[model samples]
Structures are given as C-alpha cells and as structure tokens.
Target: MLSDDELLRYSRQILLKQVDIEGQLKLKGSRVLIVGLGGLGSPVALYLAAAGVGELHLADFDSVDLTNLQRQVLHDSTSVGAQKVDSAIARLSALNPLARLVPHRTAMDVDSLDAAVAAVDLVLDCTDNFSVREAVNAACVAAKKPLVSGAAIRLEGQLSVFDSRVETSPCYHCLYGHGSEAELTCSEAGVLGPVVGMLGSLQALEALKLLAGFGEPLIGRLLLVDALSSRFRELRVKRDPGCAVCGNHNG
Candidate 1:
C-alpha cells in the first residue's frame, strides 16, 4: 500500500484510470534493473524513478565524462569523474526518495549480470554496445525475465519488449541478428541527444505497463522513432522460428 505521502506524491500518475492506486501498488512492489547509464539509460532512469518503481537497480561501470553531459541528463558538470551509477543514484534519489535506487557501479559481466537479474521482475537494456545487448538478452532468456530493449543512434531509435515468459515474444537476438559487433555503434556513428531521451522514455513506459499489467506491451513489435522527421513507426516483429533463445527450432 502506498503511504499517504506516496499517495500524494504520485497523485497525478495514480489518477489515471489505467494506473489507479492499485496499479501504483503494483509498481511499488516491482523491481527493475537497468543495465547501462549512458544516453539511452538517462530518461529511463528518470521516468521510472519519478513514477515510483519500488526498487531500481542501476548497473554501470563508466564514470561521468565531459562528453556524457550532452545526453546523460542524470549527471551534471559537477559529477564529472564520479561513478556514473553514483551520479544516477544521486539524481534519482532526489527525484523520488521513496523509491530505493540501488547502484551496481561495476561493469556487468555474465556472472554479475546473472546475480543482478535474479530478483528483478524486469530488465531495461540501455547499453549501447551490441555485445552487451546480446549478453543481457541471453541472461534474461535464461532467467525467463521480461526485457525492454532500446537503442538510439544518429537520428534513429528503436524500442522493443522481449518477454521470455511469453512463448511468442521475441528476444533481442531475434530482432538484432546475433553477430559480431561490426554493424552499428555510437562510437563510429553519432546520435542526437534527444533521440536517446525519446527511446528511453518509451522503454520506461513499456516497463511500467509490464509491471502494472495495464496495457498490451510492445512484445514482438519494434517501435521506430525518426527524430529527423519526427515520425513514429512500429514494425511487426515476430519471434524467429529458429531463434536459439526462444524458438522451437533451436530448442
């Protein structure tokens, strides 16, 4: 149950018919793990923390650098040189002290990722590297967890939900063909700051809907955002029949 303070703090969100007090309670009881603290992770952290997600676990190994200020709104100039998780935690706490914002300030590896995800209900994949995305997806599939995966580069962004708990939902590997890290990257390419924010917010929305059991999630659909044209498009994406993670052929 929400305390009187919480009831007051989240009054606007709770007032939504789809997110009444009961739904608020569900959010309060949920644990969400975010696997990055960069551009893509910025708005996800802010919105989820503002919405009163009970426990938010932030995992990131990078420290605040000057270049990060352009998109990583969680940290300011003063936070440069500090741990990214530290900057994220401080800002998120200030936003909603009621929510427990736990920070894993080290780089996530297979073993650490497994342990971090064990108790969480949802995972938000905001990491920029393809390898990290694949690793996070594999772990989520192995643990049968739901993942809201998002990416942004240049002027394009994408959002999708992979619920291993659902037989038809596709994993990250399904949408992004498992391969070497030679395709897309923020390093070689440039990304608009707001593009990342837009997708991150969508990721938070997907996570909230999943936790509250309110709306149909993106599941097998890939929502694309083109900031250059301000166009929002969603493509039908189905689980691959031969997908090794959650397909029958590989199983």
Candidate 2:
C-alpha cells in the first residue's frame, strides 16, 4: 500500500490510463538492477528512482572523472574522483529517499553478475562495450530475467529489450554473437550529451513498461536513433535458433 505522500508524489504517473493505481503498485514492488554509471546509466538510474521503483542496485566500478560531466548528468564537478556508485546514490537518494539504492562499487564478475541478475525483477544494460554486454546477457539468460539494453556513441543510439523468459524472444547473444569487434568509446568517437540521454530515458521507459506490464516492450526490435538527423527508425530482430546463450544449442 502506498503512503499518502507516495500517492501524492506519483499522482501524475498514476493518472495515466496505461498506469493507473494498479500499475503504480506494481512499480513499487519491482526491483531493478542498473549496470554502469556513465552516460546511459545516469538517466536510467534517475528516472527509475523518480518513478518509485521499490529498489535499485547500481553497479559501476569506475569513479567520477572531469570528462564525465558533459554527458554523465548524474555526477557533478564535486563528484570528481568519487566512486560512481557513491555519486549516483547521493543524487538518487535525494530524488527519492523512499526508493532503496544499493551500490556495488566493484567490477562485476561472473559470480556477482549471476547473483545480481537472479535477485532482480529486471536488469538494465547501460554498458558500453560488447564484452560487458555479452556477459550481462548470459547472466540474464541463465536467470531468466528481462534485460533492457541501450547504447550510444557519437550521434547514434539504440535500444532493445531481451526477455529470456519468453521462448521466442531474442537475447543479446542472438543479436551480437560471441565475436570480437572494435570497441567504441564516447571519448574517442564523441557522443552528444543529448544523444545518450535520449536512449537512457527510453531505456527507463521500456523497463517501466516491462515491470508494470502496461505496454509493448522493445523485445526483438531495435530502436535506432539519429540525434543529428532527428530521425528514429526501428528494425525488427529475432531470436537465433543457434544462439548459445538462449538456444537449445546450449549443449
């Protein structure tokens, strides 16, 4: 049951036809795991907390750097050199003390990753490189948790949701196989602040939809965003029958 203050705080969200009191309650009961505290993780963490997610587990082994200020909205100048999770927790707690915030300041290994995924209702992949993304996907597949993945570099951004609990749904491994590729970083390629912010916001939206069971998630569909051209395109994707992570070929 929501306290009167919570009811008043989230009144706007509750008023939405797609998210009435019932949906709001569902959100209050959902636990979310957010991986990364960089550009994409910033907005994802902020919005999920503001929306009253019951608990949020933030994982980021990095620390705040001066370079992160431009796109990493969650950290401010004072946070320079501070642990990313510390900075995120301070900001998110200020936003909604009612929402629990757990910080994992260390890098996530396979054991820790699996443990985190198994405990959450949903996992948000705000990671940058393919390696972490692939590992996160495998963990979610084994745990059968829904994963909302987002990425941004330069003026481009993309969002996708992979729910392993659904038999026909695609996992990240289905989209990007276990292959090596040039890893791009915002520092080298240069990402517009708003570009990553846009995807991060949408990532939060998709997570909320999945948790509240209110709308169609991005599952099996990739939403491509070109901030420079102001264009949005979506490509339909499907599960790979031979996907090692979520296919029968696991053997």
Candidate 3:
C-alpha cells in the first residue's frame, strides 16, 4: 500500500496511463542492483531512486576523485576522498528517503557477483570495464535476470537491454564477444560529461520500463548515440545460439 506521501511523491509518474497505481506499486516493490557508482551510475541511481524504487543495491569499490565531479553528479567536492557508494547513498537518500539504499562498497568477485544478481529483480551495468561487464552478464545469464547495459566514451554512447529470460534477447556476451584487449576507458579516451549522462539516463528509463512492466525495452536492439552529430541510430541484435554465457540457458 502506498503511503499518502508516496502517492503524492510519485503522483506525476503515477498519473501516466501506462503507470497509474499498479505501476507505482510495481516500482515500489522492485529491487534493483546498480553496478558502478561513477559517471554512468550517477544518473541511473538518481532517476530510479527519485522514481521510488523500493530497494537499490549500489556496487562500487572506488573512492571519489576530484576529476569525477565533471560527470559523476552523485558526488561533490566534499566527497573527493570518500567511497563512491557512500557518496551515492548520501545523495540518493536526500533525493528520496522513501527509497532504501544498499551499498556494496567492495569489488565483487565471481561468487559475490552471482549472489548479488540473484538477490535483485534487475541489474543496471554502469561499469566502464569490459571484464566487469562480462562477469556481470554471465552472472545475470546464470540467474535468469534482466540487465540494462550502457557505455559512453569520447563522443559516442550505446545502450541495450539483455535478458536471458527472453529467448530471443541477446546477452551482453552475445553482442560483444570477447571484447577487444585494446578497449579504452573514459579516463584514457576522454568522454564529454553529457555523453555518459545521456546513456545513463536512457539506462534508467529502460530499467523503469522493465520493472514497472509499462513499455518496450531495448531487449533485442542496440541504441547508438552520436553526440557530435546529435543523431540516434538503432541496430537489431539477436541472441547468439552459441553464446558461451547464455547459450545453454536458452537450449
């Protein structure tokens, strides 16, 4: 049951015909895991929390750096030496005290990652590391959970939703098989703040659609953003039958 305050707090979104009372309840009942509390994770966390997600499991092992303020809006000058997850908690808590915040301040290895994925209803992969992304995807595949993945570097950004629960949907592994060893990070290649912010915001929208059961998710499609030209393109994606991570699950 939504408290009177919850009803008032989320009235705007709840008013949407697609959402209404049922969808607001769904959002309040959903538990989400957000991996990475950096550039991409910032907006994802903010929107979801403000939207009234019941519980948010935040995972990040890095401490705040002064440089992160440019894109990581979840933190501030006072958080420079604090852990990212801690800073996120402070900001998100203030944004919506009705939302519960769970922090995973340490790096999650295979076993821990598996447990985390299993505990949540959905996951948002906001990490910038390919290896971490692959690991998170494998865990989601094994747990049969939905994953909303986003990435941004330089002036380009991409967003996708991979759900092993959907037969035709591709897992992250199916789309980026054994990613390049030379892949660059934002720190190395340099990314505009709004580029990551855009992808992260989209990632949040995708998660809400999935959690609230309201609209189409990017389950079998990849959205590409070209900030320089201010254009958007989407490519159809299919699950790889031989995908090492999710193949057996589908079979």
Candidate 4:
C-alpha cells in the first residue's frame, strides 16, 4: 500500500498504463546492487530511490574526492572526506526514508563478490574500470542474475542489459571480447558530467522496466548516445556461443 507521500511522489509513474499499481509493487519488492558510487552510479541511485526500489546495496572503498564534484552528484562538496557509501546513504535516505540501504566500504574480492551478487535481484555495472566491470559481470553471470551495464566517456555512452535468463541476450564479454582491447578507466580518461548522468538515467529506466516487466529491454542490442551531436544509435548485439562465463554457465 502506498502512503500519501508515496502516492504524491510517484503519482506520475503510478498513473502510467504500463507501470500501474502492480508494476509499482514489483519495483517496491525488488532489490538492486549498484557497484560503484561514481559518476554513472550517482543518478542511477537517485532515480531508483525516488522510484521506490525496495532495497539497494552500494559498494565502494574510495572516499569523496574534490575532483568528482563535476559528475558524482550524489556526494556533495560537504562530503569531501566522507566515504562514498556514507554520502550515498545520506542522500538516498533523505530522498526516500523508506529505502533500505546496505553500504560496503571495502572493495569486492573474488571470495566475497558472489555473496553480494546473490543478495540482489539484479546488478548494475556502473563501475568505470574495465577489470572491475568484468569481475561484476562474472559474478552476475555465475549467480544467473541480470546485469544492466552502462558506460560513458567524453560525449558518448553505451547501455545494455545482459539477462542470463534470456537465451538470445548477449553477455558483456561478447561485445568487448573477453580479454581484447586496452582497458579504459574513467579516472585516467575523464567523463563529461552530463554524459554520465544521461547514461545513468537510461540505466535506471532500463532497470525499472526490467523489474516491472514492461517495455523491451536492451538485451540483444546496444544503445549508444552521443550528446555531442545530440544523436542516438542502436546496434544489434549477439550472444557468442563461446562466451566463457555466460555461455558455459547456463543460468
């Protein structure tokens, strides 16, 4: 049942034909794990919280840095020395006291990553580092969980959903070969402030749709947004029959 505040807050979404009372309930009953509290993860957390996702698990070992002011909006200037998870919790709590937040201040190692993945209904790969992205992907694949991955740099961003339950959906490793191409980290190559927000917002939309079972997700397609040209493109992405993690491990 929605409280007066919830009804007022999400009235727009609640009134939607696709996201009616039942869909809202599904969103409220869902659990999501957002790995990384940086640029992309910021908006993803805010929108999901406002939309009333039941629970959220946030993991990040880094503290709030001044340099992140432009993009990591979740952490304000006042939270400079605070832990990323701490700032995120405070922001989300104030945004919606109804949300249950779990914070992890340490990085996820192989031993503990699976447990994190297992606890959530889905995992959002917002981490900028390719290595960590791969690790998160592996964990989701192993747990047979859906992974909504998004990335942005300069003026371009990419969004995709890798649902192991969907036989035709492509895994992250399938698009960017398992170990090919030089890894790109957002730290070294800076990301435009709004670019991350744009991508992250789309990620939140995709996640909500996935939870509510509403619209067609980016399962077998990659959507790329170019803020520079104000254009967007979608390319057909296919699952590799030989994908080591996703293909071999039948979810």
Number of clashing residue pairs in every model?
Answer: 1, 0, 0, 0
The whole-model lDDT of each prediction reads 0.89, 0.92, 0.95, 0.90
Top candidate, metric TM-score: 3
Candidate 1 lDDT tens digits, 45-109: 99998998999999999999998889888899999999999999889888988889888988877
- The sequence of per-residue lDDT tens digits that candidate 3 reaches over residues 53-140 is 9999999999999989999999999999999999999999999999999999999999999999999999999999999999999999
Give the worst 10-residue stretch by lDDT in candidate 1.
Answer: 242-251
| Model 1 lDDT, full chain set | 0.89
**Stretches of candidate 1 exceeding 4 Å from the true structure:** 248-251
What would the TM-scores of all predictions be? 0.96, 0.97, 0.99, 0.96
Candidate 3: Cα lDDT at 196? 92
RMSD of each: 1.5, 1.4, 0.6, 1.5
lDDT of 3: 0.95
What is the Å distance of residue 153 in model 4 from its true position? 0.9
lDDT of 4 by residue, 122-223 (tens): 999988778888888888888889999999987889999998888887789888876634756667777789999989999999999999889998999999
Candidate 3 matches the true fold with a TM-score of 0.99
Write candidate 2's Cα lDDT for 37-110 as tens digits.
89999999999999999999999999999999999999999999999999999999899999998888898899
